[model samples]
Target: MFAAWWKLGFDTTLLAFEAQSVIALRMAKLAAGGTAAQAEAQRMVSEKVLAAGEAAMQLATGASHGAVVAGYRRKVRANHRRLSRGAKAI
Candidate 1:
């Protein structure tokens, strides 16, 4: 009976350790994935900002596509207003 109890206790401890290790590994993977996703999102936002700036410059120089650029600028302004309102609410 004593040997059986000791064996059971050891087995429980080992199982607990394995569970903790698995949880730790999963958390690490999630953190890494989150960092990668954040970087990608930032890169995409930068590209969008650069494109918008180029469009604005073209509009300022009275480019032939003024109508299309004006529409895009309007859309961008609407999005900014929506985002600002949401941020203020938060």
Candidate 2:
């Protein structure tokens, strides 16, 4: 009876350890995924800003029509607002 009790205790401890390990692994995966998503979002914002800069340069150089420049400016402002909102969310 004593040996049986010892065996059961050992098994319970082993199972608990395994459960903790699984939980830890899941947490690590979630953290990595969040980091990757944040990086992608930042990259997208950078691209949008660069495009906006290009648009402004073209406007300054008088390379595009007034209507086109105005449209690009509007798009840039929209993107900036979106980025700001996302930042607030984070």
- Identify the candidate with maximal lDDT: 2
Q: What's the C-alpha lDDT at position 64 in model 1?
A: 42
Candidate 1 — which residues are off by over 4 angstroms? 34-90
What RMSD, rounded to one decimal, does every model reach?
Answer: 26.2, 25.9
- Cα lDDT of model 2 by residue, 1-90, tens digit: 787667656655554555454445434444556775566557656866876787677878776444444454455455455544555554
The RMSD (Cα, Å) of candidate 2 is 25.9
In Å, residue 76's CA in model 1 sits off its true spot by 50
Q: Write the per-residue lDDT of candidate 1 for residues 1-90, one digit (tens) a residue.
A: 787667656655654565455445434444556664466457547856977787777778887453434445454455445444534443
Q: In lDDT terms, how accurate is model 1?
A: 0.54
Query: Per-prediction TM-score, please?
Result: 0.34, 0.34
